[model samples]
Target: MRHAIGLKIGPVAFRVGSDWAGPIAALADLYRDYPPPTGVPDYTVRLEAARPWRRWIRPSVTVRGDHMLPDALPLDLAHGVLAAEIGMNLQLALGERRWLLLHASSVERDGRALIMSGESGSGKSTLAAVLATRGWRLMGDEFALIDLATGAARAFPRATSLKNGAIDEMLRHVPDARFGAALTGTPKGRLRHLRPDAQAIARMDAPAIPALILFPQFGRPEAAEAMGPAETFVRLTQASTNYVPLGRAGYDALTRLVTAVPTVAVDYPDTDTAVGMVEQLWAALP
Candidate 1:
């Protein structure tokens, strides 16, 4: 570990070490506003060169961490920031157990959380990002932390990864927003990272009760429908990364969430329309 940086995103902390200095430097600049990680980190992520010579001859960053995929591929050095972000996310997805990690984005208003879960290209991230710009506090854009005991939604506000058309859309919405270099030709295709707003970074310790859950789908006609608890529970089980690993705790927490929170499946054609729809749905909440 030649170069390293420690970061604390809400309840979790990570000490990331890299063989090259580039990734660490990039991480420092991007996460400049985050609170410094304290004590021993919750997990460790190593960004290492695939081979000794490869560090200089076309560097490749291999994400080796606390928990890993046996056959995961290494990323090119040019995508060091992406590699580092991936490394951190990989650790949480494979290692976290204290809190239920949902593959979703979240925002908050009046101490109530709005959680959106969907598959990739479902525009959850973009919707959360746009919502954040309009008075909503961005809780997270990748993973939402669901507390096991309280079922509260904790903040995990990392830099939001904007891909494809989303990059241009955000650029238009926030012309002066902090954005990382656009890394093209990556696995996810034409990606960029948008730093979270200052309020979100500064108040990362706050947690909110889950008031609403949305299964949002993009590239569709506008519509909204209530989801039964049974269907919501099943969909969330699929969305969760550590549901089975947590056993009874996960099961109980998830059941409570699905039954208590008003879950809805929403469809929309664009961010603007989705924003209006979201406001309507949230306002309808008790």
Candidate 2:
């Protein structure tokens, strides 16, 4: 193995190159821990054959092996370690800045922002793609980093993972949208990386203070109902990757965000309805 890149995510650092360097270094920087005390990443990966674009096994990890094969090992072993690393980095980078990585899908229009948080298979990414195609700038999908002090949200503009029916669902809206090859047999079914809007890619690492925290749950019929601040706070913490890991820093950031911003809950049946609800939310922003 050749050490092609070097990075530091808080306390942990990595030296790897070529085939595994980019993803490994990123994993180390983003998550910050390895599998157990061995300090080796524990995860299998499927690369996009481009620059810095990949889908993570919910928890990703690196290990000592002659081959980086995806199907050879237990998924749990890798997921645990890699997820820890990504979670750690998320806490360090965002938490230090008093930001929380709200587990949500976020997009921006004009100057307003809407964050849609939900579990996997909730069509968050599909909605994000729809908004981006309709000219709403993509802020982030999967994670929305909210700046506590300024009430802004940052963008972690990685590839949008589309799975199962979502691939065709988004293609209908974004006919020209580019995508990486499909990766199968992992967690989210058959998944592909949807390229972000070019401008959003340029501002991938940028952060913005939020105006609204909308928790999205795609249901039978499209609808959005605003939740109280207190309920939003609990959900925010639960949605975070490193809320508890950063201890005081994470807690303080979440408190500041919930207090300063108007948090709400939303539900929509399909991508179109979700995007419409988001647009409404943005229009109502002050």
Candidate 3:
């Protein structure tokens, strides 16, 4: 690897090295505010050419790291930044055991956290980005870290990956300097990474009490339904990346979360309605 960059996002630290300078430069710019790892990084991601000769040819990047999928495919050099980001996420998904990792986006207000999880088009990431711009503190966009013992939501404020229309939507509220270059023709379609607000980066270490859990569904007629503990438990277990790996500890942590937090399933037609729905739900929380 010729170029390398180290970044710390909340509790997780990552060292990413690349055979080409492009990926490293992109990461350095995107993660400019994040500090390097204090000691050793929690994970290391290496981006190398698929073959030695391929380095200067029509280059493609192979994502190799501490943890990887057996048959993971290589990505074009143009998408090297995405490959590095995915590599870091893969390491945590397959290796982390320190906290109960939820495939959710989270934000905080008044020391309380609101967690939102859903499928690919859930709009949770966009909602989180908007909320952070509004008044809530963006804790995380990809994975919401929940303490096993304390049940608090720890901040993991990485750059928000906004896709398609979501990108245009965020550009309206967030400043131009806060966004990364647009990348097109990726697995997730055209996307851009939005740097979290200054406040989110500054307060990335703060932890908030788990106050609400939401399963948000976009493009639906507006509706909000209460979710029972059993349903919430089942949904979260499926959403977690390492629930089974943590064994009984994971079970207990999730149980505590489901029981203590008010869970709801909400459907909205657009971002504004979705935001209103979240606000209403939060206001109604006891």
Question: Model 1, range 112-222, lDDT digits (tens) per residue?
Answer: 999999999999999999999999999999999999999999999999999999999898777554897788999999999999999899878999999999999999999
Q: What is the lDDT of residue 28 in candidate 2?
A: 42
Q: Candidates' lDDT values, in order? A: 0.92, 0.59, 0.91
lDDT of 2 by residue, 144-184 (tens): 76664565677765557678788888778765337655556
- Number of clashes recorded per candidate: 0, 27, 0
For model 1, state the Cα shift of residue 206 in Å: 0.3
Best by lDDT: 1
Q: How many backbone clashes does candidate 1 have?
A: 0
Q: List the residue pairs that clash in candidate 1.
A: none
Instruction: Provide the TM-score for each candidate, comma-separated.
Output: 0.98, 0.68, 0.98
Deviation from native of the Cα of residue 227 in model 3, angstroms: 0.3
Q: In model 1, where is the ten-residue run with the lowest total lDDT?
A: 172-181
